[model samples]
Target: MTTTEIAPAPAAAPARAAHLYQLDLYRVITFALVILMHVLGATTFPQDVVSDALETPLHLTREAFFALTTFVLVFSYRSRPPRPMAFWRRRVPLVAVPYVVWSVLYWGYSLLTAEQPVGSVAAALRALGIEIANGTAWYHLYFLLVTLQVYLLFPVLMKLVRTLERRPWLVLGISGAVQIAVTCFLSYPPEGVEYSTVSRFFTTLLPYQFYSVLGAVAAVHFEAVQAWVRRHRWFVAGGLVVTLAVAETGYFVSVHNGLWPELASDAFRPYLVPWCVAAIAGLFLVGTRWAEAGRRGGRVVSWAVDRSFAIFLTHPLALALLRPLIAFVGDGVGAPWTTVVVYPATVALTLVIVEVLRRLPWSKALTGRPPLELKRAAATAAA
Candidate 1:
């Protein structure tokens, strides 16, 4: 669906920076939520040690948060439209460098942990190629891969956004329908059928096209959406609650029937789209109130948000290293309580580690943080 009509792009003015802090709050909260989801995930793998009622809802929240990343990306891009090639030159390196570095790190970790065996250099390279291609080097790295894919076609996405500006519902409707089809087709497969290659590609970018496109439309029309959300704040909040209930119910029913044991746990399930959209809108409205709190609130919130991407890259490692401690706590608190404790502990530990990593030479290439002064000095010396 193409439209020749273009609506005026919204200005991301500097004076309204505080208003944008709501987005930062969303980022920080969602980053923590993702870590929590992964923590809960540990219960189901290799052994089904603990099952919690919170799992489906938390898992869905993590997937829903993908919209925040795209929203921020497109919002920043429209604020300062870059030359297409220049955009790639500047942004691709930020993701690619870290992706390669972390892939190597996770591969080496796998070898040390006996998950992968030592092999010839050529074999190791080949294995690494597969891991990077499938975003299997680590659990969370797929987000980087997906974002990179989206970045490659970002210009075209913006163009589509421009075309649909006058008819925003058309944008959401098309992307939403495709997302639903993709989600259901992928989630409810025939028994014992394999689609490894297709699954990997789906994991990358296509399933999330709706979120990215809708995010761009939201970015250009932020004020209008924000105003509508405020007027219907209670309705938005209720919608989120209702959708989450439906999703959780559907997931439990599927598991009880033994159809696809945890099929609905997959992030892209058709039921999750409504939940994601509602949750984001509800949270955005709540976050704006927090943004208006005070200067200290702003600093504290922004500080955490600034480190979120870095935290995302480093959190899995944090989770791995903390497993022994988690096991100890789990013995006493039980697995569910362990998850509750694990989420914040991991977040705190990851941020501390990331702070140190950010100060090290050339470490942004791994942590996804902006290079600090030490890195700058190292670069100057190398030059």
Candidate 2:
């Protein structure tokens, strides 16, 4: 749900500024929304219109992440450019290790939970292979795989960034148009539309290329961009509202056309591109505002940021594990109302899981973060 990206330096900050408290807030909020997306998804399991309607907007989560990740990566690269291999060497493992670990774990989990159990070890192993290859070991694992693809393309993206830097608005217009076409193919494929190795295409960098490029461009012009966004704060707010309205209306229109709720709530809708742009910009403005207000991330936000990826990895399992409890809440509380209880409980349980996992000796392998050093933590506490 996040990346190992450091925030790009702002014009007002020193070029080598190590942390952007704003980005920490941004990342933490992004991760929480991802959890909330899953929560609503689980609550609306198989599908419900109301939650589906909510999902229509929460769909911005992945695009926001892709953009933020690129912004950070490009900013860091610009600070001290790394050789392609070195960059990959340092960064890929952060995401890659977790992908492998989670894929196998979720494969086993699926076997355990399978109604039609995968009884044969060989068959199960084959399925695991397919799952990992397809980035479907679990739905969430695809993010890591897509990240790998982005990394593979990072070098090219850098070149593209430089080229776009000279023609910012023009490049954005072209890229945005391309993304809209890609979104149409993904979100509203014509009846009987098909393509080769389609599963791979479905998850390919093609879908997210626009967002990634936007991030790089933003990093390239961090100051000018921030200035522009801040200057248009009201317009950003209004645009988000209007786009969300249009998108929500589009969702119901799809439903009206007899699409299933899940299909109607598809994340890649043609209408979502503008909304995602507005939402990400809106979030950035807010993040900057928080920074302006002197709200450093502090210990609480830092702690969450450190374990955010693990929280992303573990939250779904928490939800799956809490199914019976959720069902009880749903049955007792009724439709849409159940979310009030489920979301916080899921987040609490997730952080609890993350806390336990962070203490493990191989926490980074599982969490894409450094392992907790409790003794050092205690000494620091004493200080």
**Model 1, 48-95: lDDT tens per residue?**
412534556666444455577667666666555557898889888889
Give me the runs in candidate 2 sitting further than 4 Å from their true place: 1-17, 194-199, 376-383
How large is the C-alpha RMSD of every model relative to the true structure? Answer: 6.0, 3.9
Which candidate should be chosen as best, given lDDT against the real structure?
A: 2
Q: What overall lDDT, based on C-alpha atoms, would model 2 receive against the true structure? A: 0.82
Q: Estimate the TM-score of every prediction.
A: 0.87, 0.91
For model 2, residues 221-304, the per-residue Cα lDDT tens digits are 876787788789999999989999989989899989998988888877887788899889988888877777766545777777
Candidate 1 versus the native: TM-score? 0.87
Model 2 lowest lDDT segment of ten: 1-10
For candidate 1, the 10 contiguous residues with the lowest summed lDDT are 1-10
